[model samples]
Target: MRDKIESSLESAIFNSRWLLAPFYLLLILGILALFVKMLKEVAGLFHILMTGEGNLIIAILGMVDVTLVANLLLIVVFSGYENFISKLDVAHNSVDKPSWMGKVSYADLKLKLIGSIVAISAIDLLKAFVNIQSTDQTQLAWQIGIHLTFVVSGVLFAVMDRIAFGGKH
Candidate 1:
């Protein structure tokens, strides 16, 4: 009787794993949508620049910002899902996985999030600079402060991660 009960419980748990699969699929789909959005933003930047109505540097910087953000999202969504929630089953027989994938623990993910936030914030600040005619100085200053906060937090996380991981070589 006890054996039968244990088997039933094991089956329940195994079946429940499928529930997480849909969520992971949704995350992958969301990343694809973000990629499309990034392309749209880049195309818009080119359009604005070609029309000679915008500051070229600001437009370019905006594109850079979007690209960085897109990359950050890709790393987080893909790595986090694969590491924490899903079994990616990346081929053992293929080329070895990248070092970053091996090194990116949950702690590292948090630190990278902070760093990405800071970078994105600075990009926004640069965009604001391009719109000096309409942008409030107070708003720009506030963004700068927020960006610095992210930067400092990221640095602290890196230090903590290093100490905890014994400096991950």
Candidate 2:
């Protein structure tokens, strides 16, 4: 009975593989959505700058936000699919998985993800800075606070990664 149940469970998991098909489809949709969002941001910036109503610094900072997010999304989607869900047969045949992918092991992925979030937060702080009408000391203080959070979080992740990997605590 035990053997039979284990075999049945294996079969069920195999059959459930089809459930991931929709997830893959959604991943494609996400890629398209990112593209559309980036284009919209660009167009909005262009219109604002052309009319001289936009701060060029803020507009450029917004572009950086979009670019970083797009890169983060690509890394998560592709590496996640390759590592957890399915092996990339093509990657195996090619020169080792791309450099970024190689570095993003299951252990390393967590640290990298935390670091990326910190980067995103820093970018947001930068955007806020660009919105200054006059040099507001309070705003600058808040920016420093946010940046410190980013720094602490990054250091924590690094320390945790090293500890978990038995390199350094």
Candidate 3:
């Protein structure tokens, strides 16, 4: 019957969301790689400090940049999984769980993503400014332009989300 065939097709389409689970798992691997890179950077920072060859501020900025990226990845992993896959059944009293884990809607995820991008861009811009003497004028201009673009885009996203959600979120 047409109704039976339609029901089967609907079920198949609904179950297709599971296909996204593997992609999220791959993101976990990417996070592991980022952790390794952060460890290397930390070791390099210590070496520079001991040898007295590198600028301390620049080294610290590098660490901050990595930390921001890790935080962004965490947000994406937790919120993306919850929003797309299924709810995480963590203990209500568990201290290890993030309070915002179950609450970020897709629109909220977009806002968080743009905010992280802006923060990362700002950090890079600050790094460039700190080493301004060594950076070419064109390169500096481009960095500034790119950073401004990110800021503007973030603002626009926030505005649109507010309008779409009636500022309820």
Candidate 4:
């Protein structure tokens, strides 16, 4: 009876992974909201071009920032679900499946996340640089400092991963 009770408890614990399924669905909703924001950015871009008032580079960079964030969320959802919850068997048979799908291990996902963050930070810094005329020197300094921190952290993550995984990736 003790053995049966222990087996039942283990099964229940394993099946609790399904509780995370709803969180992934919420992330999908967040992605849809980002899509709407991107549409608004594109519309404003057209108006800016016609009026020739707003800085086009800044507008374009804003869109790129949104795109990068949306992509990061997607990777998290995919890798998080697959790694934590279950396999995405539907994607496995789909022709349009991303090449990276199913291949990103937990370690790889961490690297990809850091790399995306670094890219996003770089874009923000570039935007600040482009608008240096109005940017506060102190704020700019902070941005640079923060971005460098991310860069250093990313490098450290890569180095640690290499040591931990023996450079297998």
- Which ranges of candidate 3 are over 4 A from the true structure? none
Candidate 1: 10-residue stretch with minimal lDDT: 85-94
Query: Which candidate, 2 or 4, would have the higher TM-score against the true structure?
Result: 4
List the candidates ranked by lDDT, beginning with the highest: 4, 3, 1, 2
Q: Give a tens-digit lDDT track for model 4, residues 1-107.
A: 99999999999999999999999999999999999999999988998999998889999999999999999999999999999999999867888999999999999
Q: Give each model's clash number.
A: 0, 0, 0, 0
Model 2: per-residue Cα lDDT over 1-169, one tens digit each: 9999999999998767657757766776777887898788889889887898867777777777777777776677666665666665677557766767644676566666767777877887877766656648797788778788878977887888787769942
Which ten contiguous residues of candidate 2 have the minimum total lDDT? 101-110
State the lDDT of candidate 3 residue by residue for 38-120, as single tens digits. Answer: 89878888989899987778788888888888888889888888888887787457898777878899998998999999999
lDDT of each: 0.76, 0.74, 0.87, 0.95
Candidate 2 lands at a TM-score of 0.76
lDDT per residue for candidate 1 within 40-106, as digits (tens), equals: 7778778886797667777678678867777777677656765666645584345765557645768
User: Which candidate leads in lDDT?
Assistant: 4
User: Of the candidates numbered 1 and 3, which has the greater TM-score value?
Assistant: 3
For each candidate in turn, the TM-score is 0.75, 0.76, 0.95, 0.96
| Candidate that would win on TM-score | 4
lDDT of 3: 0.87
Model 4's alpha-carbon lDDT is 0.95
